[model samples]
Target chain A: MIRLEGLTRRFNGRTAVDGLTFRVREGEIFGLLGPNGAGKTTTVRMLCCLIRPSEGRAFVGGYEVGREAMKIREIVGLLPESPGLYGELSAYRNLDFYARLYGVPKQRREENIERFLKMMDLWDRRNDPVGSFSKGMQQKIAIARSMVHDPKVLFLDEPTAALAPDSAKVVRDFILELKHEKRTIFICTHNLYEAERICDRVAIINTKLITLGSPSQLQREFGSGKTEVQIKNLGSRILHAVKKVKGVLKVEVSGNKLLIQSKDPETVNPRVVEAIVKNGGKILYVTRGAHGLEEAYLKLVGKNEV
Target chain B: MRFDRVWEIAKKDMASVRRHRYVLYGLVVMPLIFAIVVPMITILPFLSAEVAGDNLPPFAPPGFSVKQATILAMVSLLSLIFMFIPAFVPSVIASYTFVGEKINKQLEPLLATPTTDSELLLGKALGAFLPAVGVTFASFTGMVILVDLLTLPIFGYPVLPDLLSLVILFVYCPLIAILSVSVSVFISSKVNDVRAATQLSGVSVLPVLGFYFLFLGGLLKLDWVELALFAALLVLIDAGLFYLSKMTFQREEILTKWK
Candidate 1:
């Protein structure tokens, strides 16, 4: 549903968005993970045709970014990072105004407004001016506005930012529902867990895209495995004995505790325990090492070299 | 969205304008006082002097007589066109048109839709232009009737507003207003702050002031023939300004650089 090739945007002398290249499938939820100031907003703006790219090109719904932005706008719904709303207008009026701008037929406008507002739990406040709404409520209204016309694709820039946990959950679930409805969604956010929860595939864009894959794939790539084995009073003797076990790559002992590295834990764990017992070392506890996604993310982002 | 849709947006804008009672009062009531009340206060002495026949000072140097008094009065009232009509006010409105949306975080979604720049511009121009024009015209007529009725017996003439006055109000005021709205919208597109756009757009009235000074100095006459020509010239200029505004406006530039 979206294709970008070498897409870039520069402000003054600074490069806001570098040569970004990616593709989002028709019905997949794509996560754009990045740290703050990583040009996530700039990327989304270019896709929505709110701003032109400094170099390269982007296509949304088969419409070219610069040349056919108007056509693209017809099919794509955008929820900007900041909730842009007319404070004076009521929630209903805000949605109504946008629907008119989208040329949603007058006949269906009321129904659409009613549906979205109710979904956001903003039906009771529909007549109250948006200025009076709390920030979370305003965010929900913004979400509703973007969905008013029900476009084919949604470009949500930090959709869950500043929301209370419950409201944020609603937004997350709504995005999941959009995915089920077969709509392409491009989510730009700093919240990795949110992306992990809803995205089919995630791309981490640091200085550039450092990695792209499912969470499990990335965890497997960067996570390290080191088993911690404990012995009651092994001392240095047990470490030496376990080091002789087949498939045991390394072993270290501190007091009675042994930290071991094994390429195949299933194959070597039993042998290592048996060896420690045979050598007169009392075995206390042993647990399989686990790799975590946070470790993988930190490694991928260059927080740690190894 | 088409040009017709622009009118719908303008109507909604008007409704919003009405909702803000204080802003509405400021735009209309304040101008009415300056345009009608102040002029009457200043003109009271002249009317009294004309009645006393005490060294009947020239109403307006030489060529301005009581017969042309209404013309002079209306022309003087044209200052309200600048002072109150808010030719620069369009800057505030136009600035609010998108920048307000941006601050409120409403612009991105609006721009994300299929609404073309031209359509957006049209909607904005109407929203700003109609109110500015409406207030200006209403104030002018209100003052004219009040002054003519109040001074009819004292001046011994019906404040004979000529075809020239009609032409200036109908033809000239609108042209100047369009020019004002176009220039303000252009500035608004570039600036994110509503106040900054307003202050920058307020500069649009300088040219109108220059013309007023020229007319007062007798350097530029407002005779029927000359008035018609000026009206035509203003229309041409208004059209040029509209085109220039359209050319300079790029949604991308507004979304990015304005910040």
Candidate 2:
């Protein structure tokens, strides 16, 4: 639903975003990962038509960014880094004001406000001024405000940055619900665990696209393929037999556990288990190692830290 | 331009202003003091007592009776000085609306909407303009009534709804309000702090104050010709300031240049 080709933006003499190229498909949850000053917010602003790209072109919902900014604004919703709400106004008035700006009719505006506020669990406090709410509640209201018009694509910048763990879970589940409804979502976040849990695909960048793929795909490409095996009464005899198994590239012993590395764990795991069983070792369980997307992301963007 | 969008923004701004206690105090109190208290304290004493010709203020015109001339001079000077009320009141409201919103980061989402730049500017201008003008008119009405009631026994005729009152209330107040709003817009774009924008916007009323002193110092008279000329000059300045403000209110600059 969004496409960027060599998209770049410069402020004064500094380049905020440089030569970015990527595509997000319909109904896909695309996460944008970058360190500070990596141009994540700049990229989202370009697509939202809040700022024009300095060079190249981009299309959001089939309308060119600079040429048809109004059209793109009509079809897309953006939650900026800050909630940016009117603190003196009630939550209902805040959403209603935006609904009018988007040209939503009166009847539909009321309905959408009611629905989204309820969805965010803010119906009970809709009459309170937003400034009085906790940071997490305010974030939920902001998320609801972005979806009030039910746009085709949503761009959220740090949707859960200030939320507590429980509130973050609520927002995450709400995003998953949006995914189930087949809407395109673009998220810019520093929370890698949340990104890994919800985003169908993610892109790591440092003024340029460093990597883009599903979380597992990225982990596989940049991470070590290590598997951990827990066995009862594990000793050097079983370790030697498991080490001799075909497809086993390396093996190490740690307490009653075995660390095995293989080019293809799916192919090598069965042989290693069989060798352990035949050697009279009681097997407990075998599982893949930790998700290494965080390591891959840090390694790629960690250099030249600002 | 879509007027509904404009009205929506204006209405929202008005609602926000209503909830701001300090701005509301400025809106109501300043006009009351300028329109009611100053006139009553300064003009009512002149109507109650007899005055010698030598004791008359310099601006009092000679052809009429002492009572007539003194009442007319007092009403005219008070009405002209009241123009400063409209000019000063809008700067307070506009500063709160523009610079306060910027400080709170509330402009970003509003700028992201489908509305055009002109619509947003016009909406905010009207939001500040309406209340300032409304209070000015209300205070002018109160002053007219109070002046006429006090002077009717001495002059045997009501001395209000005169050319000065009509021109100041109908013409100069609205233009000065627009000028103040436009100036506040420009100042808000240049400065990041609300107090700084408000302090800078206080300069907008300097021209009005200059005219008030010129009349009070017996250098200028309150007549149709002088009023028309001043109104024309103010209209030109208001147009130029509005255009400059619109040019400065670029969405891209606001998004990028603000720290």
Winning model by DockQ: 2
**lDDT per residue, candidate 1, A168-250, as tens digits?**
99999989988888999999887777876888887877646677887656655665545667887776576778888888888
Task: Identify the candidate with maximal TM-score.
Answer: 2
- Give the alpha carbon lDDT tens digit for every residue of A1-306 in model 2: 999999999998898898999999999999999998899999999998888899989999899999999999898888989898888999999999999999998999999999989988999999999989999998898888888888999999999999999999999999999999899999999998899899999999888888899987776677666678999989888999999988888887788889898777767889999999999999998977555578667777876354
RMSD of each: 5.4, 2.2
Quote the positional error of residue A110 for candidate 2 in Å. 1.5
DockQ of each: 0.61, 0.86
Per-residue CA lDDT of candidate 2, range B1-259, in tens? 9999999999999999999998899888887887679888878888768878777778897789887788778888888878888888889889999999998888888888888889999999999999999999888888888888877887788878888889988998999999999999988988888888888999989879988898889888767788899999999999999998898777887788754
- State the lDDT at A239 in candidate 2: 92
Off by over 4 Å in 1: A225-291, A303-306, B16-22, B51-88, B154-161, B189-192
At residue B226, what lDDT does model 1 achieve? 70
Leading candidate by lDDT:
2
User: What are the lDDT scores of the predictions, listed in order?
Assistant: 0.74, 0.88
TM-score of 1: 0.83
Residue B198 in model 1: lDDT: 71
